[model samples]
Target chain A: MKKLINSPDSVIADALRGMAAAHPALSVDHDTRVISRAGGAAQGKVGLVSGGGSGHEPLHGGYVGPGMLDAAVPGEIYTSPVPDQILAATKAADGGAGVLHIVKNYTGDVLNFRMAAELAEDEDIRVSAVVMNDDTAVEDSTFTAGRRGTGATVVAEKIAGAAAAQGADLDAVTRLVTEVNDRSRSFGIALHAGTVPAAGTPGFELGPDEVELGVGIHGEPGRERGSMAPVRDLVAYALEAINADRPVGGDVLVLLNGQGGTPLIELYGAYAEAVDWLEGHGATVTRNLVGNYITSLDQAGFSITVTALDDELVRLWDAPVETPALRWGR
Target chain B: MKKLINSPDSVIADALRGMAAAHPALSVDHDTRVISRAGGAAQGKVGLVSGGGSGHEPLHGGYVGPGMLDAAVPGEIYTSPVPDQILAATKAADGGAGVLHIVKNYTGDVLNFRMAAELAEDEDIRVSAVVMNDDTAVEDSTFTAGRRGTGATVVAEKIAGAAAAQGADLDAVTRLVTEVNDRSRSFGIALHAGTVPAAGTPGFELGPDEVELGVGIHGEPGRERGSMAPVRDLVAYALEAINADRPVGGDVLVLLNGQGGTPLIELYGAYAEAVDWLEGHGATVTRNLVGNYITSLDQAGFSITVTALDDELVRLWDAPVETPALRWGR
Candidate 1:
């Protein structure tokens, strides 16, 4: 693969170095692969921690800052961080109140984070965990037993992190994160698969005229393959799947995320279709984000994430967030 | 081409619809294809107007906000906007203090913006223009009379837009934009060419192990084509080009821009090398932006821009900007 990396093995380390240089507000622990706030966790607030593979950037790591993740533990590309790495992040984030782990639903990630949580508990640290499985694309995937977590992970990190930053206790923060995940749904489509640097080839291939519907972030098999269609139709299919599973309505927050290689022009185009679909179906979009948040390496695709929102969720989302990936107000 | 668009012919319109849906702070005029501040231009503030082809998203249109452009006129993909559209934007942006046009160095863009300035003059709207030609790759190329403008356009917009928002007159805004362009230098390398939707194919081609160095945003030929190497070598080559054209030293604001398809992970990795190169070369990076700010559709590449900063420029660079692509502070 023609990637801008020194080597496949050094990708995460190199990127962390860059992040540390670019964002002085966040500190990178190169040895442990934990990105945490430069000022350290607040003394009385519950610390927010999230992590996963390295490919989906601006996810766990880029979200670290005030009003967001306190620490992010990144593993190898598409590979879950080991228990040691997660434990390091957990300890770094703990501020005496407690630590909340926001994890995506993947077998490796779930197990690793759980193991880390257990390890943290052995040290007398109270830790609460929320596993996100918002992807409606499939019930199981190559690395997941339940629905693969996708775009909703960003929503969860932001909303729940806001609550944690506002002095919520570990239990309240955990409940908010769980609620965000429960009210969220995501679906993805791929025009092309992302190539792993080590593999030097795309994980899968697509015919010139075909598209993968409901594709997972790691190039896992989706529900089915379909012929190429207009963005409106593609968005409709994604929304239909989400509606079938959750029946979206009322005030909602939306994320039209571009898989790595998709252009912002196309993301905006697709976002228009999503907004049209949502408003036509009686849902009022109160807040929206259109760009790459959780990307799958260099995959060319897009994911639609919808979160049914209440007044409190909306307020939290609008609250100041200072992170590399998602920042506003502050 | 596998793009998330309705049709090649409807790409701009559809994307505009999506932009309107996604950003409530901006107003999009479908008929004129102009994006402007939703709350209208501030009275007595020098209005900033910038525009060009459509594909390089978040450049002209996305920069329209409180601290950036007052209006942006977008043309068809890779095609310069018509004088009428530019004139409309100029008129829309005109406050009592006059307007400034930030034009890239493409031949068509310069000519169109010039003509629009003339039209605005006929309508009694004073307009000043600054043409950016910061690419140090080549003196002249396919669509440019001199050097082609690349990544420095975003720097010019942010710094100069801040001046305009601070109530700088049109002349001062124009001068500051010109200074930004003069102090800045950029170079790009592409692993693959971006495919224009209308063309249905890549603008250019590269062998599996080759890369196009100093490539233009429109896929125009660059300085040379060379075999693929590590990102360090590639970044060194780009910085070398910039340093050769204009010696880089002292405080510098750097932008490591992704050419559409490059992942944020890779961009960050590349950024590390850039920071190392700049520091090693006796330049201190006072500010930096790493992401896809200016893009060329779905091309796999990156461009590095370094602007030598003085105290005033640094202050303006640190000013609040709220745009779809580049945002920080208030």
Candidate 2:
């Protein structure tokens, strides 16, 4: 693999060290593999924590900050963090207001976060959990028993973070996050598979003229392998799937996310095409984010996320968020 | 060859359209191929304008905002923008305090921006220019006459933009950017070649376990090709080259930028290694940017940019600036 890494075993730790060094706003726990805000959790504010695998960066770790996540526990690449790690993060993030755990739909992540929440409660730390299953690509995948969580995880975290910053209780934060997941859907297409550092080879290979539509973030096989087509056609296919899953209409927030290896120009181009298509079908895109937000470790593809935005959701999203990955109005 | 583009001919236009849609804060003129902050340049403020080839995204277009460039002109991928586009941008961004043209050292870019300035002078608009030649990689390459401008362009624009926002006149802004360029040096390494949409092929090729150290942003031949080494070895080599060109000590601002395809996790890992090496050598890295700021399409590599920072530059950089690609204080 032509990746800039020292050893596969040290990728997460090395990255954590670098993240801590680069962002003074974040404090990394080398022992627990947890990244928390520099000042720890805010007192009397709803504490938020999230984590999954390591490859999809700027996700859990990048989301830790004042207005977003209080702590992020990262595991090995494409693997879930252990329950102990999650428990440690939860405890570290628990302030007087209570803590909220943002867990993805992966079986391992869900189970571990569940155990972590229970463990935190055993220590008398109030904890609530919101499980995200927003990927419409597949109902089940290699590591997931339900729909895989993808782009909407960012949307959920941002809105929930804003709500928490507003001094919302854990239950309110939980409800808002769950509502975001229910109102959102995402679909991805990969032009090439990403090579895992440890594997030293592409997770999968594609024919020169083929792409995997509805590809999972972990490089899992997608809906089908189809011949290469124009970007417009590919965009239409993904949007159609997303629209079908959740009839995209009214004011919606769109995320035209690159799956790592794609260039920003292409993602913007895709965003333009998506906007044109969505407006043509009568949906008004109220707000949008275009870049590599939730990526698949250099997989050359893109994903589209559509979230039907309510007035409160729009207000919360527009509210100040100060995270490494998503920052604005701060 | 695998890219998410409608056609090689329409890449720039499509991307521009998407940029306009995604960032309503900036206005894009399809006819002039320039992206300016919405509502045009701030009246009475010294206008800052920059542009070049389109491939290095979030550079010119993404940097247009209140505290950054007043306007950006983008040409075709890896091709310098025409004098007409530059002239249009210059005219539009000409505030009463005059406009500062931030041109890279590429032959086409310099020539075009010069001609554009002359054309603007014909319209009785005051203009000053700063040509950045900060790349320590090569003195001359396929597309340039002197050192190619690389990551330092971001630093120059950011500081100059801050100066402009503070009501600095054209001359002051020009001096700040020029000094920033002189103080910064950058070196890049490419593990794999980036494919240009128009070419339908990789610009260059590398063996399975090889990398081109000191590679130019446009895939120009670097210092040498060698077998892939550990990330520490790679980091050491890059830092050694940078320190040789400009002995990096004292307080410095470092940017560990991805060459497009490299993931953030790896970049952070590289950042950690760089910090260890720099601190070990008695240099204090006061501020840093670790992400894909300046990119060469989806090239699989990274570049390190270190700017010996002063109190003034730090204060200016810390000032509020809002742009699509780089935003912090604001």
Candidate 3:
């Protein structure tokens, strides 16, 4: 229960103020907790918007940049933003070109973003959405609608960001983002649990030498929990699961994401192991990223994401993006 | 440490095999451990190279893209790569255009990369290095030798990568990286310690309810350790240190980096807090990033980086880069 935050209730409010201050390119609607780059809208570009729990940061907000999302709405730590917040961000990012919503497959996120999308439709604003359900962690879970959207959310944002920046219409953006979700798969392992500021303690518990496999980002119970194994075995089990579910035997774009606290070197280890497995399985990883892209709050574990890539995705992946989280193009 | 690897001795080896298999675009040399994109390496172009401990994934290696590093050498988790490994990578990346070493400001990393550079020089392959010392955490403690390099290393590699991709000579690349290092500074705090595989325990320790300020990547001892405070106070402390030391009063590029295990949402919170702090203090943030750019394996904490941006650096920062970690240009 020990954390460094001030009053847990003020964490989100304080954080929003800080984000607005750090990037002049971005602004925060403190009243609604909507975050947009200072540029308001992309003039003639398709506006992309995504948001979810506050703890999976840099997702909606960080990706708000040139080739990425125009706006990101954040909820409190590990909670979904309100529907009104999503509406505000959607409106803020909307230009002449229409808007796209990239919602991770979660009950709260789905319900909230969907409600707002319907509201936007009523307002006569063109809005489309692609619900990302790339996590193979839960084939059938009572807590989730279906597969939980874990790490592949990053791929959705990156690909969709690039597409929107290239002047893709809302439909095009939705198509591409959906394509990314369809092509990508993810699974994760947690060695230690995380603290959800409000709960003030580890979301779940493991002994000093324990680990959980096929875990979701929100500390949902994994498929299995056991004594901590070596990184190699861990990677093997994780990669095997992802490989079997998704069959990444084609040109692939991959991301090895930390669920908050796993170190970069360890992620590399997991990546290295996954690479060997993929190659052995006859997969061609054309692009790769080894870092904490999508994460759970300070959870000590990592996840591997594989997006079976096509030439179009490869091209879109290479487009210029200049958001707070991702940027490129001279 | 209760890690999930078969053995500490073979962790790197197994991981390498896995990486090679998962990423066909990035081929790893098991013998020398040099990772590069297949068919990459512009012939006759000055090759940019960087490396450090294995824990900082997507770093020296992930940044190996068109406008960034040509090769990235990895060491054991949180341990520096030996000189022979560095030399091997340098030689492999060497073209007639010479080689540039993007070194971080750590005793082990600097020593290893420096020795490799010297060896390369003796072999008549012109080499230059930009020792990044951007972390303003512990004054005069950014490195065992001097100031430590933290988040700014990304900026250095990115700028240098762009220059090298444009066929800039080694000297020019070195100058560009140096300029970035000079203009940028970073500070970090650790809410928890990290697990170093070899050590099998945390790299450092703090109370469950405590936070450490001014932490280094390798879990190096931070400057201050105190009871965990609120997010605002924590960010304020970090920002004040950076602002006082580096003084980013004008247009600046801000980076809120996760130390391996922090969630993006938390990082966003930190980013938000940092932005507010900067603005409240009369600082103008031009660009911002919040993610796990630079990490300290499995550490539950975050870092903040600020780079004073000008026209040239911004332009260079905006250049296209194609690497496993960052790809913008195809």
- Indicate which candidate wins on DockQ: 2
Task: Compute the lDDT of residue A279 as modeled in candidate 1.
Answer: 94
Q: Could you give the interface RMSD of each candidate, to one decimal?
A: 0.7, 0.7, 3.5
DockQ of each candidate's interface versus the true one?
0.87, 0.88, 0.42
Better of 2 and 3 by lDDT: 2
Tally clashes: model 2: 0
Model 2, stretches more than 4 Å misplaced? none
Sort candidate 3 into its docking category. Answer: acceptable
lDDT of 2 by residue, A162-188 (tens): 999998998999999999999999999
lDDT preference between candidates 1 and 2, better one: 1
Using DockQ as the measure, what is the rank order of every candidate, best first?
Answer: 2, 1, 3
lDDT on C-alpha atoms for all candidate structures: 0.92, 0.90, 0.77
- Tell me which of candidates 1 and 2 scores higher on DockQ: 2
lDDT tens digits, residue span B1-330, model 1: 788989999999999999998898899999989899998878899988999998998787988887788899998998999999999898888887898999999999999999999999999999899999999998999989999998888999998888987878888888899999999999999999999999999999899999999999999999899999999999999999999989999999999999999999999999999999999999999899999999999999999999999999999988998988777894
